[model samples]
Target: MSDISPTGLGLRHSLSLTAGTPVLTLTGIRPAEGIRPGDRLVARSGAVAVLAAETSTLPQAEMVAIGASTLAHGQPDETLLVPADQPLLLRGARAELLYGQSAVVLPARRLLDGQLTRLLRREDVELVTLTFAAPAAIYAGELHPVTRPEPLALTV
Candidate 1:
């Protein structure tokens, strides 16, 4: 999948994906905001051109919606889907998970607040750091010895 940067563009014009395609379909009140077809959309996933069609149907629904899921070797095992059109959030200090004997860790950051954090925490979350930015320390309070000392001569 391609990645797109969310830069310029009005909030009402946020991008939406249809059937996992890069093409964006404008919905909600955005169309009333003068966001016509053929306009460009700046999405978190990437930029996409608006389709020349308006959807009068309701927003599509997903059977299983989770925030994030970890897969191994491109195999789908664990899946976390998030329903609704908003973001998720996770609280606490840190989050950790062990899937198929593999560990998945997510550090807490302040920017994770609101929807992002809530959505994550709502699902199968392990640890939460609860900070806007990662700790300034090298290991975030993880203790480790600097160096081993050499033996001294005691017979002198």
Candidate 2:
């Protein structure tokens, strides 16, 4: 359809991201009268709030796209595409579907000492992960600290 176009630039890669999988996504504050996709909203709650017509300061690390089949109850009447790096959270019906097709590349590194060094030193590493089943819970959303750092800080 005319509504779907590939002109907008952000992160567009070919990969299969299933619905309901935890991927970073946004959630817009609902209005008193209620709202739908494409309906502009003034965020009044969440990690941060933004006045209508203003930019937001909320970090986009915790947002994730959910599967379509998962949103059977309280389905939003409308669905709209959310911008990848914007603060305006879009909540309507099936907006998470737009994000479900995303392709995420996990970070990996090689060490000179490799497995032998890690075994000898007995060093440990951890990877954090989360999953939400309810559509409402997914819409409610959560925020987490990014694994990557800007300036590189050491922790002891």
Candidate 3:
């Protein structure tokens, strides 16, 4: 299959495991799920991707760049968390890959200047990850989701 997106953007057609309940990745200093109970809240996004846990389920040809999870998704020891009240910036991101499977977080301003996929390819990398410890948006030109958030109290 060709890696080129027919529209030069991206094709959105995956079913969210949440049964089409659209979600926003909470961006910034967030922990794995379960840190805060019932805090399954996610940041809203005009940008989202239909994702499957495995690459084989969703064709790689469809993705310009991929982040192969820094944390084990289903690992027994891994815990997940979400923030109820978080400050969100609905923008895109450009992930600077670090030494190993880790990711280097950069300000989104540095990312907004160019298309994320094309930028990464230009930078000579394919594995771009969005840090959940900051405001990271992934839309058409960007990749999938990851998030973080500054501490905020839950709102009623």
Candidate 4:
């Protein structure tokens, strides 16, 4: 959390994005989303999310594969899993779910599941923001990005 600065990564050099779904929702929660009248999945502020892949097209489109049941591994439709304490990538960004739960808006549409998406970038990787809001309604926390350690060097 310390390493993540207030300033997010730069996207000026990016070219395009692929194999991901960007999502955002202000309201509305369908039963398929997996939020029953008693489900309590809301948290405080969100954590710093990791973004190593690149993306483009949608302005502030985040490539996160959002879903409800982590048990079910597949596409994100109707159900969206709000990442707790995960980095919130801006549009055209992606989230790897680092730690801590920040304020989320909770996209009613499919979560997009960007974490699982591996986009083709103009560069090595790109970062995006993923907003989550409980069906109740929460404010944006203005969180930071997930910083990965330097590439590992293997030698003989």
Best candidate (score: TM-score): 1
- Kindly indicate the candidate among 2 and 4 with the higher lDDT: 4
**Which parts of model 1 have CA positions greater than 4 angstroms off?**
1-34, 58-156
RMSD of 2: 19.9
Task: Return the TM-score for candidate 2, rounded to 2 decimals.
Answer: 0.17
Error of 3 at 62 (Å): 27
Work out the TM-score per prediction: 0.20, 0.17, 0.19, 0.18
Model 4 per-residue lDDT at 37: 28
Q: Rank the candidates by TM-score, best first.
A: 1, 3, 4, 2
Q: By the TM-score metric, which is better: model 1 or model 3?
A: 1
How far off is model 4, as Cα RMSD?
15.2
RMSD of each: 22.1, 19.9, 16.7, 15.2
lDDT of each: 0.25, 0.23, 0.26, 0.27
User: How many angstroms is residue 3 displaced in model 3 relative to the true structure, after the best TM-score fit?
Assistant: 40
User: What tens digits encode model 1's per-residue C-alpha lDDT throughout 28-57?
Assistant: 223212444565434333333543333332
> Highest lDDT among the candidates is held by which one?
4
Cα lDDT, model 1, residue 39: 55
